[model samples]
Target: MDYYAPESLSEALDILGRGGVTPLSGGTDFYPALTPGGPRQSLLDITRIAALHGISRQAGGWRIGAATTWSEIARAELPPAFDGLRAAAREVGARQIQNVGTVGGNICNASPAADGVPPLLTLDAEVEIAAAGGTRRMALSGFVTGVRQVALKPGEMVVALHLPDPPETAVGAFRKLGSRAYLVISIAMVAMVLRRDGAGRVDHARIAVGACSPVAQRLGALETALIGARPEEVRVTMANLGALQPIDDVRGSAAYRLDAVREVIARMLREAGDG
Candidate 1:
């Protein structure tokens, strides 16, 4: 019922440290998921905190503030390796949602179909968390524990995402399959970053899939298999996708998701490796 928008990180943390307060950002997900006539909860809006609002260069890579909007990410002049992430940013929702929905909210919500997670997984992103005690960092892969779940401890909040420097030659791509092209929940999605050597053999590969499992998963087997293969020779089999565990849902069947992921991976390989 009560809404508090703090101007500084310290102020926000102070409020968050007290139990029973829900941290709110853009509320793109919060407002929609609210139960009609449910008990009201106090809100601590973090959007006003200046520390959580930009994309800046860090020691070894880039730091994307938690409060950074999808629109900001889509428009930022980032590197080729970030192309997939930027593309995913544009696909987050409608223009209005993109203008307000933030990076932190998307991650904290921990939805399997979240467009941002796949690209971030491929980038080997790290989540930065803040608490009243101190700050800590963890791999994005480990941060999202399951569908609609995360590893945030009580009193802790995600502050930013850190991406390590990717190979200079790396290029990234994202592909999504849904019932509709826009404003639809994905049935299967793939994101990948690839780099070719002078001889045109894949030298680096990072692939991830979303919407087919509890948490978005990195295709470690596929990445390893692609290491010495040419872009045109890339092949993905069930063996290479051992990490996925797609389930049957109203949107699609588990078998359909696996098949769709294979097709999407093929497209992503060509786009990221050939482009």
Candidate 2:
């Protein structure tokens, strides 16, 4: 297999523009997907590119470099609003996988059970795409078109994730239901960001659910309904969670996932209110 690790973004883009090469970083997903003795493809390793390295604050919010690993995110000194994301980072895989699995790779892999998606959705994350032509940004929600699919066109690659500043008082939580405590794919997962008013009523709420839909989805209707409710008064019904379309699988049944989400959402709201 041909391997090229470019040290600069321009060089990386140039190679990608030529086509017939796969962009690789960390290779946590790539290596696992390879079939032994299969037709070998050339690899364009972008990890050495300086531009895609760390997490930093920009004018609007924060920028997480595409090559930043899950371990970095889990240990970063971020705010309370990032708690859910950090939690997801810690749960991405075992310590070994977390050390090398890039958040960018997680998003680009576009798995329905991806631990990062629900938290990122709640953060309103944006995907920054780079190419030989230039760069562009898109909402995370629209970037992952379906299971194992992304919106990148030819010669395009994700460079970083951009998040807008959220309410200073916002707090986030994440919950996952899996067969085991560690190293298991989620049966269902929920992430939420909550901000309260002076009267202790919810002012801002963003809720997302994963492994229960084609793509993780924000509970827009539920978020709207919780606007004026107190933490203790929060209620989640199957009707409010209409955004998710769960399917029966070996891990869980669609009905069970829906039930689990309601409970998780309720608990997260209560904890957010109490804290």
Residue 108 C-alpha lDDT in model 2:
95
Off by over 4 Å in 2: none
lDDT of each: 0.91, 0.93
Stretches of model 1 off by over 4 angstroms after superposition: none
Give the CA lDDT, 0 to 100, for residue 74 in model 1: 97
Give candidate 2's total backbone clashes. 0
Candidate 1: residue pairs that collide: none
lDDT for each residue of candidate 1 in 154-232, tens digit (9 for 90 to 100): 8899999999999998888888888888898999998888889988899999999999899999989989989888876
Estimate TM-scores for all models: 0.98, 0.98
Give me the overall lDDT of model 2. Answer: 0.93
| For every candidate, C-alpha RMSD to the true structure in Å | 1.0, 0.9
